[model samples]
Target: MKRLLAILFFLAGGLAAELAHPVQCTLITASGPQQKRRKAQ
Candidate 1:
């Protein structure tokens, strides 16, 4: 019984950590002068 409880606790902690992190995304504009600089370099 004690071993089973310990296993459950370990699994729960792992799942909690996994759910804590969230995804992220960022966007950049591709307007005229910015596009020109990229091509020039």
Candidate 2:
């Protein structure tokens, strides 16, 4: 029972990390072009 709980906790952490990564990447990507446009202006 303890082992199963541990495994579930680890999997939940991994899933949260996987979910957060793309949002960070998209935020960076979304901001990058705007910064460049500002510089150009």
Candidate 3:
């Protein structure tokens, strides 16, 4: 039972990580374009 629970927790953690990576990347890249515009000004 403990092993099963551990596996479930690990999977959930990975799923959460996978879900967050795209959002984090989007936020970083979104700011990059804005920064370039600011530099041009």
Candidate 4:
């Protein structure tokens, strides 16, 4: 249970960090989604 809570806290921290800076996230998503969606076909 402690391990699970630690992982959750880690993910939450990373999410907060990302939300604090969105340009990199938008660029990654924009470049990744096209290739991923094409491959999913």
Candidate 5:
């Protein structure tokens, strides 16, 4: 169906964007753990 294709396309675009800026993704992921550690402290 057209809607399914559109949803798949949207997901693919998001993945491509994430891959295009791996450093940003890494920074985001890295910050999450630090925030959790801060909360624990």
Candidate 6:
């Protein structure tokens, strides 16, 4: 039971990291379009 709990904890941590990475990348991508719009003005 201890081993199973440890594995689950490890998986949860990795999944959290993976999810955060994509969200950060998407925010940067979304902001880039606005920067271009501002520069045009």
Better of 2 and 4 by lDDT: 4
Q: Local error of candidate 2 at 29, Å? A: 19
Q: Report lDDT per candidate.
A: 0.71, 0.74, 0.74, 0.76, 0.76, 0.75
Q: Which residue segments of model 5 deviate by more than 4 Å?
A: 23-41
Q: Write the per-residue lDDT of candidate 2 for residues 1-41, one digit (tens) a residue.
A: 99999999999998899887744554444434343345555
| Tens digit per residue, CA lDDT, model 5, 1-41 | 99999999999998898898764744444434343345555
Clashes of each: 0, 0, 0, 0, 0, 0
Angstrom error at residue 4, model 2: 0.1
How would you encode candidate 1's per-residue C-alpha lDDT over 1-41 as one tens digit per residue? 99999999999997776688533223555457544345555
Q: Per-residue lDDT for 12 in model 5? A: 99
Q: How much does candidate 2 score in TM-score?
A: 0.51
Model 3: per-residue Cα lDDT over 1-41, one tens digit each:
99999999999998899887744554444434343345565
Question: Model 1 residue 21 lDDT?
Answer: 55
Better of 5 and 6 by lDDT: 5
Q: For each candidate, what TM-score against the reference?
A: 0.50, 0.51, 0.52, 0.53, 0.53, 0.51
lDDT of 6 by residue, 1-41 (tens): 99999999999998898887754554444434343345565
Pairs clashing within candidate 2: none
Ten-residue stretch with the least lDDT total in model 4: 27-36
Candidate 1 C-alpha error for residue 38, in Å: 36
